[model samples]
Target: MATPLENGFSAPALRLHALDSEDLALLSAHVQDALVRVGDIAYLPAKRRFALVGSRFDWTAEMEGRLERCRAGLHFESVQRVRCARVSRDEPDAILELLAVTFEAGPEPPGGVIRLTFAGGAAICLDVECVEAQLCDIGPRWKTAARPTHELSSSESGAP
Candidate 1:
């Protein structure tokens, strides 16, 4: 089998869209450990959009003895409203580590709540008309020594 690089495949900047639950899951995986400053988040009521910029861990690139992170932008369209919990607006400089993105359907079809969960019990919920979101790598990547890790819960470890 030809190596990925040998086959002329190169790591390119990510530009992805999420139109449904499955797509959102993939997008979430790419941004699993992104670090976002509270000040970077914005909700444009006039445009019906919610956006944020973050330093996203580059999971696609080869480690090559070092980790990497790059600036990324994520946005959701047709957003009706935004609600946050455990994320204080008073602390603009505070950084939050993104954990996952999930969707919960509303009573009406094609409408739902998109939740962005972060470390320290912080979360942002977007009331959206549909699953319409985009994630793009917006800048050059740099090397990093730190890799994010998640501790498994007792139930997840199959232990009593």
Candidate 2:
């Protein structure tokens, strides 16, 4: 339960440690509107860890102005393509909004999978060496080309 900025400037800009399933669940909720490029994912089994970086797009009033410019079909130099899309499981054809990315760790032998759950139930699971992974923030914020449209229904998410 720490903010991405909790550790101060010396931290990895954004990094989480010992994040179990419950931790990931909480993180998914915090990273509500991050952007992810579907094709930019990687999992290296030999390292016993997987790493995925996302642009911080948790939206604020200042970003609203940039979002409007993007909507007007004007490309904002401040907005990088990597910050405008999300990861999708239902459809891998393009970048999609990042709703949540969960890590389910397996027993010894160091194995698990990183599941990137996009808006809706769409998700992409990456088999990794283990649950040792760090999602860091490595890019500037940008206005999304489009906002995702989906609902996280209780019946669908099964969280009461």
Candidate 3:
């Protein structure tokens, strides 16, 4: 069994990489409900990369009785193109709540569309040559009082 750190933290700052669908799924779960600003998103075509920085809620810490958030950076490499739907680059200060990251395979192997879904139907799609992505915690964690919640629809919740 692994022991907690001297400060009683169970884990160090997160640094994760995804080279395949399964790995991306795990990374997605860790970043669920992260808050991102529109201006923080960038696509560097010269570098074939798309990146963003956000405040990621620490779900792991929540389970340990500490609701906290920390700065995190996520980037995708080998990006071929980028698209946005219901998201405006004009509103640089607009905040988005990240809901999920999902992949839809293209006709060619290892090439696919990686979708970053946000609340309010906003989404960003990255056409990539392959699944090469990284997510890293970039700053100190600070306590927050609120934890994200989802409301299931009536049918899904067994309500008639």
Q: Which predicted model would earn the best TM-score?
A: 3
- TM-score comparison, 2 vs 3, better candidate: 3
**Where does model 3 exceed 4 Å of error?**
1-11, 151-160
Off by over 4 Å in 2: 1-12, 59-93, 103-114, 127-130, 142-149, 153-160
Candidate 3 lDDT, tens digit per residue, 1-160?
2224335555578999999999999999999999999999999999999999999998888888877788899999999999888778899999988888988899998899999988777789999999999999887677777999864333321101
State which candidate has the highest lDDT: 3
Regions of candidate 1 where Cα sits further than 4 Å from its true position: 1-10, 62-66, 151-160
Provide C-alpha RMSD values for all models, in order. 6.3, 11.0, 5.5
Clashing pairs in 2: 86-96, 86-97
TM-score of each: 0.85, 0.49, 0.88
On the 0 to 100 scale, the lDDT of residue 94 in model 3 is 99
Tens digit of per-residue lDDT, candidate 2, span 16-92: 44345665565565455655454544444444333444454543322434331111000001111121123333453
Candidates 1 and 2: which is better by lDDT?
A: 1
Residue pairs whose backbone atoms clash in candidate 1: none
lDDT at 69, model 3? 84
